[model samples]
Target chain A: MIRQANAVDFWRGLALVMIFVNHIPGNYYGRFTHASYSISDSADLFVFLAGWALRHLVGTPERQPPTWYLVLRLGGRAVTLYAAQIMITMIALAMLASVAILRDNPLLLEWHNAAAVFHDPIPTHVGLAAITHQLGYFDILPLYVVLMVMAPGIAIVDRFAPNLLLPLSLLIYGITLAVPISIPTWPVDGQWFFNPLAWQLVFVLGFVMARPTGIGGVVRQHIVPIRIVALPILIGFVFVMRYGWWPDPTWFPQPRLFFLFDKTFVTPPRVIQFLALVAVISVAYPTIQRYGPRLVDFLSMLGRNSLYVFCVGSVLSLAGQILRYLYRGDIVIDTVVVIFGIAMMAVTAWLPEWRERVKGRPAPKLAPSS
Target chain B: MPAPFSRDCQVGSTATASESPLPNVAAALRDKRKLKILAIGASPSAGRRSARGGHTGETKDILQQAIRGLDVEMINRGVSGELAAQAAIRIRNEVALHEPELVLWQVGTNDALIYVPLGELEQTIVETLRWLKERKVDVVLVGLQYVDRMAQDDHYRLVRELIRKIAAQENVIAVRRYEAQRLLAQAADSGGGLVPDEFQRSETGYVCLSQYLARAITLGVFGGNLRPRELQNLPPRPQN
Candidate 1:
């Protein structure tokens, strides 16, 4: 029997599309992306799903992986993410440099914080390799890399003292927000676009929620009540965000990150909104999968091969921005960009499965929770 | 005397004169013996593309030369091809992080290129300027660069007009880079092509921009209550 497309992959795939649209700043489609009406955009969903995947990687009580194996696997994955970030950042710089030289527009050289690479290549290059300096629109992976490097720690805590896992994550999240602590950029005095310290809360939430025991089990048991409570928040925030109804920043007390709806530090409001969103989607996705099987399959494929599609999407988004600039981002140009760029991402997602088929090996199965 | 960095640098006088007090910048210079400026713009506002560190180095040197024992720390956060909305966001983040007292916001060119809706652009500029004002941060709105094609575009002209209006309304200093470049380009045109058409792409263009900025900043900090002509004709510091 053919397996149905799962919600995890489907939502992850949709998040990828949202990210693609939002990444291309000034694209006409940007007006309709998830961020327009939601306090938290696809970035939060993306990170949360990544943490969900870590649940499988860490394994369950019945078939837990050895601590050493988990460390090596997560470490290797971190290396891959690091390599991808470095390669893409270099490619992005090269793309900007080529366009700048060819079009006789040096301004292209400076887009998305690439000016540092051109102006101060040596230090910036070091910063790039070290993940201390990240190009705009290309920053999420550095956060992923850090989170992946911390995955072993996460697994150890879950394995040994599972009770303390979430409280510890929340404690870190609280400290990050209250102190307004973030990883600072090097070779440039700035903070990371996504603060991993704060983001790890969402990741840990995903991890814990994926489990059938503990708070995850509790949430799963009371999901209907949770959905009821979450529904108003979801509906309420849509209007709140749309109308700009949040309290004024001036009104926020000191250590404002705790109160403000900040993306970088993953503030409380955003987290609350995102969790409410997830709750609502949990119920809605089944109906979606039943009614829109093809759409579900398509998005599931994108989600299954998220890393590959995301890498392709990042480059494509940059290309889309350049194209929009060159041709002007009217609705027509934006439509073409969105359609073509997403198609390329789909192709990227398909190639690995095609390779597996060609090698006479079955495509790897998603983890049980996934 | 012609500006040392660029020969076609007679545009310094055209920088919008501001009676608006740059209180923080003035105070920083007085007490700390240091000045920190964050230059956030599109292209040459970062520095010259052809000449590495050209505009930034030139601006620093001019500022330091003008005020002995004054340390000028400059931050170049110029992302070429950025629109007003995007730049405004970064400006907030950078200001919050770096706490720069003055922001040199070179805007309008890229927004004009993309034909960003006039009201949207105006709102972003007005909102950001007000936010900066709330923080007591001084802003110098460097207007669009002169491009021949954009000169005829009505939307482009409107965007330029909007920048001027916003600058005046916000009481921030404005650098008339477009007017200066257009005048220089026109003069060069009349003189049979002495200056490059794309002033923003050339070494001279960025050098001229740096000189204009350096002069405007120096005058803003020091030449308070001076008339525009006096600010323009202010005597150069004696060479050591």
Candidate 2:
């Protein structure tokens, strides 16, 4: 039977909410999200959870699917993500253009790195399809698509040479950081907000850490001491983030991406702090499940339908931002936007299961689960 | 075709053109027969052609015409309503990615509008400017637009002044957008014509802006150093 409320679903759901809140810049709720306290925000957690779920999708050795089947399924998922990204981008542009026309404000067309679509349509359209033109705040899915495409290779590496998997991932991550390279956006001449080469490390770390052997085995065995070490690092980062105590990027050596707390490259500081945050936060899942059963079930529902919820939430967040812009943002308006957006996301999540019931089949697996 | 604005309107736009050399740009033009520039900032930095067929591309054309066989390629990375601090991060990333020889940074208005702390804006600009300089990239600081109402706003004045000070201190060319626009408006008012909005949200303004930048870049690069034959193709130096 499908699990009702597990730790993975609960955390993924929480990350989705944080992402929704954070995407709407200047929303009052944004100040309270993980970004305010943690070096790595929902993007990191979301990507990591995606990597964790990959393990479940590929299945355990006893029930492992054929290599060809694994490749096809993962490849299909990547195609789906690419399609979703294109759809959302089109919707976002339509929303922006509609508002610009209704309000007679030509300036609105330029919001979120969108000016190219309006001014330079032909090339920008090609760039958008090629994943070279990503609207701001709507960039994560392209990164997800790229990661998904890399999934087959990752799976093959693990299947053939599991021992070399993480080392290879880390090598790519190191070279990406040391060389300080990024996937450039075309027609606009900027770098990807999420550097895929650098981010694969987090995804690989998630995949490996989700397993019951190797690093994962060692980590499980040393959970208590690990948490003990992690607690202080997490607390220290809270202070570091609160006080803006990061070192100057100029002071850093030639390759500044290595030391700096850059979100795009997923720098070392962010990696270390994020790992620490994970170790510390993992302790709360059991407590949350025991004491907050209703919350867990509600969140688990949303997490189960993550892709749908995420896509819907992205559109809703954009709507919320537009609303906030039209009516100057205030605490009351922000509260309404957040509540309405989240409530709509929950509704979106619930719809899939409702359809499943109507068809008289088992509850459909909306997303990969651990 | 040349821009619609009269030659007189272009005179006395910016302050005395700084004779600072754009060595990288010069070298690129010399060896590769091409100049790659990255323009990054708020709305004004976008030199895209408007629906009304504005002279946005004229900036490239003017540069190309100035030196025979020289190709001027521009990459626009402008996001409207972006603050200086945000643009600084993008500038670094873009510089690393494109490795352009010249960077045209239109700044100040959005930062002033949002009331971003002056210190933060200054630090971000100073650090980024230094970083660009270290990479041997030529920089042109396009100052804030001249808005009649904003002229009285203390923060606006402070922002313009701070950018001017940074440009002077850094020894990079500062396109005196505010001053140039003010001059054009004055000349237009005196001549009994509707002032072409040099910095506002209009195609006419964008056209005039292109000419001003092209003029400034031409002067900053050649600065009486161009061969006499090349000098014949250059515009008359605008008097202060």
Show where candidate 2 strays beyond 4 Å. A361-370, B1-40, B43-81, B88-104, B108-211, B214-240
TM-score of the second chain of model 1 compared to its true counterpart? 0.85
lDDT of 1 by residue, A1-370 (tens): 2234688889999999999999887788888887888989999999999999899888889999899999999999999998898888888988988887777665565677676667656777787889987777899999999999999999999999999999999999998887768687766555687999999999999999999999999999999999999999999999988786776564566676776777788889999999999998778787887899999999998998989999989999999888877776789999999999999999998898777656865667888994
Best by TM-score: 1
Per-prediction DockQ: 0.24, 0.17
Best by DockQ: 1
Docking class of 2: incorrect
Pairs of residues clashing in candidate 2: none
TM-scores for the candidates: 0.83, 0.77
After aligning candidate 2 to the native by TM-score, how far in Å is the CA of B69 from where it should be?
A: 13
lDDT per residue (tens digit) for residues B1-240 in model 2:
111223443443434245466788877866975688888887543325532222335667767776677787777666555768778877876676567899988888767653556898899999999989998899988887665556676877999899989888988888777776665555554553344442233333455677767766776666745322333343444333
**Residue range B1-240, candidate 1, lDDT tens digits:** 112334356533454344456778888888975577887766533333322344666777777776678798877666555678878866875676557888989898878766788999999999999988888788888888775655777887999899989888888788788776666665555553346545233334566777777767776776654444433443332121
For candidate 1, the iRMS in Å is 5.0
* Cα-based lDDT at residue A121, candidate 1: 68
Model 2, residue A73: C-alpha shift (Å): 1.0
